[model samples]
Target: MRIIQLFQVALVLMLLALSNEGRVNGERGDRQCEFNPSLSPRPHSVSILEFGAVGDGKTLNTIAFQNAIFYLKSFSDKGGAQLYVPPGTWLTESFNLTSHLTLFLEKGAVIIGSQ
Candidate 1:
């Protein structure tokens, strides 16, 4: 009787496994994978210096940073924007970020926060 019960359990497990496989295969057949270029954001780069940010390591650049971020927000629809920090010691305060904006820092670029 114990051997018969084990055989029945094994058969049920096999059926469940087969049913799951069939469901997964059917779903994959319904949808095909493809790449869409429009789905990706277009790349745009802007320098902090354009916004009057001085990286002298002493000047307060809070307003400069704010202006740069605001400018980038305007291009949020055109594939977003990228703020590039060149090789300099930028000193600024906290700032907010918009969607689809990328902050890129080059080598030797340092951002110092003012307390």
Candidate 2:
């Protein structure tokens, strides 16, 4: 009887797992500027700008970040490229927004603009 109960529980768990859905990064029920060249921004470049002075937020590699900004600015369209920062505490050191790009901050979002 115990063995049968355990088997039933395991079967239920398996079914639950099978029914669960999976989501991709920046591609769930989200709306934001996407990195598509056909779009306005034209995939000029990718930039990572942190918002907090000191925190565990992902840091944009100094040089690469600048280059990304420069690239984005240089070819900044009226509306095109997308800046995506996942949900969490993002400590930005500096943020330079370009034209035509939409900044998407997910829910439970914490964006600390440099004050």
Instruction: Tell me the TM-score of each prediction against the true structure.
Output: 0.61, 0.38
lDDT of 2 by residue, 65-104 (tens): 3454555565555345555545666545465666666555
Clashes of 1: 0
Local accuracy of candidate 1 as per-residue lDDT tens digits, 51-115 = 88888899888898888889888888888988888988988888887888888777788999988
Best by TM-score: 1
Give Cα distance to truth, residue 47, candidate 1, Å. 0.5
- Root-mean-square deviation (CA) per prediction: 11.9, 11.9
How many residue pairs collide in each prediction?
0, 9
RMSD value for candidate 1? 11.9
Clashing pairs in 2: 41-80, 41-81, 50-92, 51-91, 51-92, 52-91, 52-92, 78-100, 79-100
Error of 2 at 55 (Å): 7.6
